[model samples]
Target: MRIVGISVLCLFCAFSAIVFFTYYRRNSATFSYDIVLPTIFGNSTEFNTSEIKKKRRAFVVNVFASWCTVCMQEHQTWKEISKRTPIDLYGIDYIDIEDNTLAWLQEPDNPYIAIAADYSGKAAKAFGLREYLKLLFSTKKVNWCSI
Candidate 1:
């Protein structure tokens, strides 16, 4: 009876762990540290990571690769979202060739208010991304028209 009770408790713990981990992994949408990424276009400069956060009530940072088919399909959804919402969207081009990303963005309505490059994936690591991430909720405001 003692051995059976212990086994049941262990099984319950395992199940609970699985559920917790799955939820935590899926819902982690913010980061505590700053992520300064370089621009793939124009002057090759890094943008003010924290200052952008001060202006807007909230923003979304999307991780995408120029080569990912899912990202291409989801791009349309982002375009639609941009049309309906006032929230700004930023793009993190993940480990992709800069030229290819530039062309890719040109084909779309360009929903991102601005885009930053994560060539070495440091920004993605800072954001605690364990896998391909669609959206990461953040706060920021900027005159992206000038970027």
Candidate 2:
């Protein structure tokens, strides 16, 4: 009788822990962090990271590679999202050549509000990207004319 009671209590505790973890991981905003630079791309005269962040209420930083086929596939979805939504889009041109990135921007369906070149991968690394592949979200006022 004593051994059976102990087993039941352990089972109950295990189930409780699983439920708690599931709720926490799915709903918590642990992965979202404020980006340090606002407009990190293009000619300095055209866009500046610090300036854009100050002007826009919220923005998205997409970590992408020019050669990444998955990133390529996601481009259309991103384009649609940009056109339909009020959200500001920023690109972290992750680990790609300057010329290739330039050609990518020249694509018929350009969607980025601004592009930041991250050749050294330091910015993405600072965002602790390798820890996990998660999408970060934030909310801010929209300035539609800027786009």
Candidate 3:
């Protein structure tokens, strides 16, 4: 009976841990660090978190690649948002070639106020980008934007 009780308790603990982990993973902000990235213009810069807090209520960080079809599709939307909104827009060129990205930006009127280069995708991983996007989009704010 003692052994059975211990087994049951262990199982219950495992189940509880799984539930708690899932909830935290889904709901919590995974990236809790300042992000700095290399700029297309050959400079490294930090995301203006303080500026965004003071000036714009929010900012969008978009992770994009020059070769991404989905990114191309959404380019116009980003442009319009930048033009019309009070929110700040920033871009991360995720694992993209510099020349290709510059060329891509040239024709369509670059919408981003600043662009960051993430050649190795380390920045994207640090940001927990996939989960962050889910959280941002799920928010009540109509202006869902980010890299």
On TM-score, the candidate that comes out on top is 1
Model with the higher lDDT, candidate 1 or 3: 1
Per-residue alpha-carbon lDDT of candidate 1 for residues 26-61, written as tens digits (9 for 90 to 100): 655554446777877434376445756776667777
Any residue pairs clashing in model 1, and if so which? 53-140
Per-residue CA lDDT of model 2 for 60-121, tens digit only, reads 76778778888888889999998998878777777678788778778776888777776777
Order candidates by TM-score, high to low.
Answer: 1, 3, 2
Worst 10 residues of 1 by lDDT: 138-147
Question: What do the candidate models score in CA lDDT, each in turn?
Answer: 0.75, 0.66, 0.68
TM-score of each: 0.70, 0.61, 0.66
Full-model lDDT, candidate 2: 0.66
Better of 1 and 2 by lDDT: 1
Off by over 4 Å in 2: 1-50, 131-134, 141-147
> Poorest 10 consecutive residues of model 3 by lDDT?
131-140
lDDT (10s digit) by residue, model 3, range 23-67: 888755655435566688422355543333445356677778878
- Candidate 3 to native Cα RMSD, angstroms: 5.6
